[model samples]
Target: MKRSKKRIIKTIVFEILLIISSLLIFAPILLAIIMSIQPPEFVFSYPPKFLPRGFFVQNYIDAFKIVPFARMILNSALISIFITLGKLFTGSLSGYAYANFSFKGSKITFYVLFATLFIPAEIVLIVPLFRIISRLGWTNTYWAMTIPFLASATNTFLMQQHFKTIPKEFEDAARIDGATPMQYFTKVLLPLSRPIIAGAAIINFTYAWNMYLWPMIVAMEDRMKTVQVAINMIMNAESSNNWGIIMAATVVALLPTLILFFALQDLFVKSLVGSGVKG
Candidate 1:
């Protein structure tokens, strides 16, 4: 009875801590949103009010006028979707092969991929990458936005580890049913791998959406810029005091990722656990 009481108290304490921590983490985002809807006068008032005086949603309307907000958002979405799909498709296939099949030079190839794990993408052959993209006439184009970001070594490794947790019996059963390799992968493996797929998709989409420097370097055209880069441009173009509109733009930029996360939170959490699972 005493132990049960202690356990209850501990669980309650943990829940309280979680709530507090969540609120603390979310406070900044809340501030941005609240400030976004507030009048400029109240937003910059002395002592900086946490609660807005009133909701002035015109901030959002005004933000669109300041920049090509809609176009940039579309650009961000396009790049993120394509990159996420590419990563998931390639990651799963490479992972399945590494986890299930024994092939010549496969180990060596995998080890070479790990070399990227140590070297940061920022430092890895930027000059050559730019030159190649420029040569292909992909600079400032959708191809430039999507091509350089299609695959990730981290995604490959993660999918490989996640695939190892599945039973080989599933593969054997599919084979016994006369399924071709592609049919087995698509029909059997893909369906069962939803959790990891969701996780990878979310992660990759977020990464692609938030990319700043690469888009800035590659997409010189204002219409082709990603949301992050566009936001910076917006801020630079706006008067210093016009933060409300900027905040509103930020809120708009955050919607896709926020919606994606809330919608797929269960799968996202599962992906975290999936990463830790080994053969």
Candidate 2:
């Protein structure tokens, strides 16, 4: 009876801790949503209002007017889509080669790619990357932003690990059917790797969408600037600093990622679990 009471007390403590942790994590997001609906005049009020007195949609409306939000959204969408696709294609190919095929210096190539993960973006920012992009005349272009990050070492590692979990018999069957290597990869392996691909896509999409520094550096023109850059401009605008508008814009920015995760969460979890099992 005493042991049962102790177990029950521990369970209650854990449940309370879990609830507190969740509240802590979600508090900022909840505050942002509330602030987004608040009137601009009351946004910076002291003793902070957790709930707005009245609903005002003008914060969102004003945000669009203050920034070329529509254009920025479109640009962000296009760039993110292309970057995610590029990462998926290139990373998967590299991963497949590493996981299935044996070739001269393959280990060395994999190590080089893995080494890039440790190199901070700041270290590569000033000289090699900028000069290479400048020499190619890619400055202020979409290619400058998209091409450089077309592949990711983490994605490649995830894909390779996932691929290893798949049975070799499938590849052998494809080979017996006289399928070429490319055909086998495209038709057989790619289909089976959907869960991992979806997980990678979510990660790449979020990274490309929220990326700030590189886009700011490469995209010089307002027309070329991404949504994140546009948001920074709005925040720094001299006319007025409307926290409500800023919060509204932030909520808008976060929606895509939230939606993407909700849609692919099951596949993402499955892929991560499968990768973890293999590792």
Candidate 3:
């Protein structure tokens, strides 16, 4: 009875701590939502209000008018979707090869790939990468944004480790059933890889959607800019003082990633646990 009481007390304390942490993390988002619906006067009021003064939605309407935000949204969506798909395709194939095939220099090749994880692309890769893109005449185009990110070493490593965890019996069973290697991979392996795939998709999508610096540099044309890059235009405009409009735009930018995360959070947790490196 004493132990049970202590356990209950501990659980209660932990729950309280979790609630506090959650509120701390969620406070900025709550403030953004409140500000987004408020009037400009309310935003600048002394002792800034934490709660909604009133739901004035003109801020959202004005966000679209202030910039070619709709076009920028379309550009980001297209680039993110294409990059995610491309990464999944390339990462999965490379991961499959590493996990299943044994050949000369296979270990050395995988080690080299693993070594790339430590290199920061923004610092080490950007200059050479931009030069190549420029030479290929891909600057200011979707091709430049999508192509450079089509393959992710991190995704490849995660997938390869996850693939290694699958039991050999599944492969043996597929072979005994007269399935070819490709058929077995598609039918057996991929079907079981949904958790990892979903996790990787969300990560890649969020990364591509949030890209600012590269898009800002490469896509110099206003029409070619991504949503993230275009947000700066809002900040530089005459009405930049309107925190409500800025907050509304910020919330709009966050929507896609937030929605995706909530939708697939379960699978994402499963992937985190299952994709851990294994011998």
Candidate 4:
């Protein structure tokens, strides 16, 4: 009885500490959001106003006017969605095959793909990728933004680790019930793999949304550029005095990822543990 009580007390203490740490981490983000909506004078005020005063929404209006974020946001959404879905599909199939099947050169192929995680992307592929895209006439187009990153080694590694944790009996049972491999994969494994799927989607979506260097290189034209690139265009040495509009733009840019994470929060937490196990 005393041990149970001690454990409960320890758990409570841990949770309290965890909550405090989470709040501390989010403090800057919360402060930025508060500052974003405030009038310009209060932005540099001493002691700092931690709470929102009335709505000074002019910064947001000016942000849109100063930059064409509407089109950039839409482009980001479309590219991110495609990249996320493509990575999920490719990762799942490759992971499943590696975990379950044995075929000629399968081991070699898996090793090659896994090896890719180590090499710095810029050194090995950037020049060739640029040449290929230029030859394909995909520059300044959505295809240029989305296609190169469709396959991700990290996503495949996570899925492969997660799939290894499932029981072989599950596959045996499905086979005995006259189920084909594709049917078993689609109907049984994929359905139960929600945690990793959500994880991959969240991670890939955030990557695609926040991508900078490639988007800048590929989509040089204003209409084709992404939000991050657009943000850079909005802010430079000349715009140092207009920090309020920059903050407002940053806040608006953060909305989609924040909303997505909140919506899939449960799955996101599970993915952390799910990716680590191999049994």
Note the Cα lDDT for every prediction shown.
0.88, 0.87, 0.91, 0.86
- After superposing candidate 3, which stretches have Cα over 4 Å from the reference? 276-279
Cα RMSD for candidate 2? 2.3
User: Where does candidate 4 stray beyond 4 Å?
Assistant: 1-9, 237-239, 276-279
**Candidate 3 clashing pairs?**
none
Better of 2 and 4 by TM-score: 4
TM-score of 1: 0.96
Question: Which has the better lDDT: candidate 2, or candidate 3?
Answer: 3
For candidate 4, the per-residue lDDT at 59 reads: 81
lDDT score of model 2?
A: 0.87
Candidate number with greatest lDDT: 3
Model 4 lDDT per residue over 144-175, tens place: 98888888888877887788888888999999
Tens-digit per-residue lDDT, 1-279, candidate 2: 999999999999999999999999989998999988998667778866687688889989988888788888888988999999999998899899999999999899988988878988766655688889999999988889889889889888877777888889998999999999899999999998888898899999999999888878878888888899888988887635778888888888888988999999998898777666752
Give the clash count for each candidate: 0, 0, 0, 0
Q: Kindly list the per-residue Cα lDDT of model 3 for residues 1-279, writing each as its tens digit.
A: 999999999999999999999999999999999999999989999997777866899999999899999999999999999999999999998999899889899999999999999999898999999999999999999999998899988888988888999988898999999999899889999999999999999999999999999999899898999889767888889999998888888999999999999999999998888766453
Minimal lDDT window, size 10, model 2: 270-279
lDDT at 129, model 3:
94
For candidate 4, give the lDDT.
0.86
